[model samples]
Target: MNELPSRAHRPVRVLRVLASRHADSTRMVRPQDFDTELVAQAASVSDVDGHERYVPLCVDWRDARLLLSRWDDDCAMSDVPFLYQRQRRTATHLLAVPFEQLDAPGRAARMTPTFIFSIGRCGSTLLSRLLAAVGEQSVSEPDVLTSVAHFDDDAERAAAQGARERIVQSCVAAFEPACGPAPVIKLRARCNRAIDVFLNAMPHARYVFMCRDRDDWVRSSSRAFGDSGEALAELLKASVEAFDRMHAARVDPVLVWYEDLLADPVRALRRILLARDDLDARRAAVERALRTDAQEGSGLSRASLAMRTGDAGALAAFGARWREIRPERLLREHGLSRLR
Candidate 1:
């Protein structure tokens, strides 16, 4: 097991380690999960800007509140590729806000965010970094959003659909003030499951879909997450369903291919930015982003995966399985034929 960072408070560090060790557990985080002493010791704030500084660490739907932790000033949320990891290592002061408190009149008018959605192992993180480099405040995969996406109880999820939508809006709204007028947020790949929730919550927000070729995606996912072929197939099917839902909602999201991004990132950035000017700055930003590994130092980093050997047999088996189960018609219908 890896050693816990010394910077994190001892109780939070222990809890994080325990959570990581029990990664397969379906348990939801509750107020009781944290040390009461630590929670009491942490400073509390009621204003919106305070909430912005203390990003939503996780959502406690059963309790109808969010667990927020103050972010370190030294590292901007956009600069940290993995939000959860950073929080785990650095969070000290914690705050809990009720769902209703997040709601305010005219809150919706305050900011409009740009969302980057993707299949995992794609270049969405790189896109985020490039946007940040070009002076766009961007957050890559905040855990609060992931908690909502992976909310496991079917009955609770259905019952709290409206609340969930509000929670999504509130969280994004909290991020906007600190992130600038037009903030860019890159969500975890599995967030495709709750794309509808986001669409309904932030109707004015622009959406971008980042994707990779089918074979390469499977290989990358296997290498990174060790997901089986069947799992990858399910993810693809879910993405297809999400795309269909977006179209039904009358949203025409900008599509960005991972292959094209690698081939000519400046062109890709230009398309996503929808800007004809600033070519020189965009080129410099892309070049800087390309030199750095977007996910470096995190669990999903290539360096971490380098310790484990890739299985060729598993890759071949996944290929065969995917070819048999691929959503061929849906792929073509949704302009995702290249993925097939």
Candidate 2:
């Protein structure tokens, strides 16, 4: 039972909640509560984000449901429910799983050993798409690469295990022959660091390092994630450490630099084709990506010949930028940079 109040307050939605009755987990509250609350509210309201939210009697206990909101012009029973239909929310939280149970026991045979591991904010996504044109494979975002690979707590570990299994399922969907040509996985560089089981099973799998100019990367990063210098620095530092692992493993991977690709995308991609795959389909896809990516990355570089010529202001906007971290120098030093 829920109803809006006339307290001259900012707009907020109310949800009913309940804790799981089973006592396998000690924590009364769960992140799943947040997930369910959001889902249920979304069920009730059309513009959930625009409106502020509130839940009455939202204490640690049981019973929660989503309901539409209504305001009172002026009345005593404003917050009271029209019809009381409250019941408990979902009972199981993936967080309840133990750390030791994080890994999935499965016989996932290798179909491919190659992975496109981006050093955060690099053209990992673009490269992944380009690679998709080359081979039949599945693509994903920072997801498994971000939270799962670096699970700090038991809940995250459990989540990671589930995410890993889902990724495998994604691979199966991409190519019908599950273990035929092998599936190339694309993820952030740190994923390589945490995937012990994957590395052990697929030894031939090589990691492709996707790079971007430190400054341009920072610029793009700022647009995506604002004013978090400490977080950026920490992420960059972690990325460097992860790439370092690739070097220590003695894996001479395919390195695609951001600057080099932007400068002459076709030539750079042809070079990539020299080692990775010599098939015409792969080569053609790289060429197509070159044209498309050029349109997408038009003004990324200040020095690029193709900087927004007609719109002088856009070109000027990209002028004289530099990165706080000199990843190019570090790349060369760490042997993660490109070779002939």
Candidate 3:
């Protein structure tokens, strides 16, 4: 089991698990107090008003400790072994997300390595390395979160390939002994469900949320966005809405800014480390240099020379064209403020 690195959350408490029930055509095993507002959506099969019930079943020490995107995803019932398939699919993704995908699978370390994430170019990779340096364990990038965030459900058997359940269980398996022995996990932003999973499953975990100035973030992301990549722009707009909801919900998230973390990694990380009592005496420079021996280890870089100096100034022009942009529509669809 992973060791507890710092003073963190409590252990996983097994709530009651439910068994199978009837639904349109599927089955799910739900936990006792599963609480995601989103009802389990029906499969893509048309004309299906209800899904076959897949009742929630046993809560393994593993499942009880992993991060779940939404508790409700665990609640449906079906004979199709959807949950098992979900876990398998997640495993595939965990093995293939940009950096983490490259790691040799099933390595036998005493503890599981840290899996770091964020949407593309969100500096999650950099943060992962930082944690890796500080701890004895290695770090992987974009694990389950990115794959799920960018999942193409239209692709056949996406969930089955991902193995959603086992992947989550694996993370907790890694986290437990790692936290106890060397305190490895120091991951950054995952989709909302990732957060839900961590909070529900890993009580001894400390989650970190890294943020950037909206304008800078937008402009920075626009750097490599292709003409057809309007989804990139929409993602930023959508995140703003999500952030607002999280803030209103009064979640006490640890906020780390991209600029601050980059400008003076030593000092910034010192403060972050000092937030934990056991880490107060940890030197900033030592912490900064721990896993990340030097700059540019995170594999992040500016856009290609062509994109950086392209004749088309469309990205830069977003600054001046805000009013002309249909930001209102974007925010409305994303359930966010009309700050645009």
How close is each model in CA RMSD to the real structure? 7.5, 16.7, 16.4
Off by over 4 Å in 1: 1-33, 36-52, 154-159, 311-313, 320-325
On TM-score, the stronger of 1 and 3 is 1
List where candidate 3 sits over 4 angstroms from the true fold: 1-122, 136-138, 155-166, 175-204, 224-229, 244-251, 263-267, 274-340
Residues 87-205, model 2: lDDT tens digits: 11222211111122211223234344466666555666555555555553533331322333554467545434423433333322223232244445566455655544344434456
Q: Worst ten-residue run, lDDT, model 3?
A: 91-100
Number of clashing residue pairs, candidate 3: 62
- Better model by lDDT: candidate 1 vs candidate 3: 1
| Maximum-TM-score candidate | 1
Better of 2 and 3 by lDDT: 2
Q: Residue by residue across 92-159, what tens digits does model 3's lDDT show?
A: 11111111121122322343223232333445445555544454343333133333333333552232
Task: Name the Cα RMSD for model 2.
Answer: 16.7
The global C-alpha lDDT for each of the candidates, from Candidate 1 onward, is: 0.71, 0.41, 0.36
TM-score of predicted structure 3: 0.46
Best of the candidates, lDDT? 1
- Candidate 2 vs candidate 3: which has greater TM-score? 2
Question: What would the per-residue lDDT of candidate 1 be over residues 1-340, giving only the tens digit for each residue?
Answer: 1111123221111112222222222233334445523223222244334445677778766656667767755977889887766765566656666555564524754777888889878889888988888777899887788776876678646545557667777777677556875778898888899897788777788888888888888878887777787778778778877877777777678888888988987787788677447866567767878899888867767788787655456567766776887777778877898777
Per-candidate TM-score against the hidden true structure = 0.84, 0.49, 0.46
